[model samples]
Target: MKPVLWMKSSCTTCRNAKAKLAELGLEVEVRDYFKKPLEAGELEHLLPADPAPMLGTKSPKYKELGLKDRHLSKAEAISLMVQDNNLLKRPILVHPKGTVIGFDAEAYARLVR
Candidate 1:
């Protein structure tokens, strides 16, 4: 199966994930998720759960966009992420039906082996 990794160069998390994958000898195709927002269908599968707690900038956007006070449905979150890729969590690793966020070692281990 092919490995699809949505990556942003400047993100340390993405770089770490890439390094881990490389250490495990897993080849991945990294795409710039910032420049290209994912489709709703794609983003939907990658997101964690409802409310998307992990999704959103720790930066001022979280407060500025009022995401802290807002509650969004799955579809709403998907739409928002498509409109702004930054809304999606970093280093999303895709493999078949599974999508792992933040380059988690345990999760990526499943993909690695």
Candidate 2:
């Protein structure tokens, strides 16, 4: 099982989620969301399906940019994400079957176990 967790180095939530994963004795590969962010093509490769409306950040900047309010085409959204990695929701756990976004404890436990 490829347990790759994508995270912004500064996000406390991302740090906490990583610690939990480690506590479970799961050795996960880490992706630096800011330095080496995931691209749309990368999402398609790692995720089960193309994350269209699904890919986004709940961070203030993205919200300030009104990404959620966007009626963007798939390509448009992907382009924006490429330009700004913070556009991706943090601690996105890319598993073999699917993905976990935003560091949800209950959901992550279900998948990790």
TM-score to native of every candidate shown: 0.79, 0.79
Instruction: Looking at model 2, report the run of 10 residues with the lowest lDDT sum.
Output: 44-53
- lDDT per model, in order? 0.76, 0.73
Off by over 4 Å in 2: 46-57
Q: Model 2, range 1-110, lDDT digits (tens) per residue?
A: 67788898898988998988887776789988698777778854544344443565565657887766666566666677788776667778777756777777777777
Kindly list the per-residue Cα lDDT of model 1 for residues 1-113, writing each as its tens digit.
77888888889989999898888887888888777757877766666678465575564555667887788788887877777777767777787747776778878887756
Question: Weakest 10 consecutive residues, lDDT, candidate 1?
Answer: 51-60
> Candidate 1 has what TM-score?
0.79
Backbone Cα, N, C clashes tallied per candidate: 0, 0
| Candidate 1 lDDT score at position 109 | 80
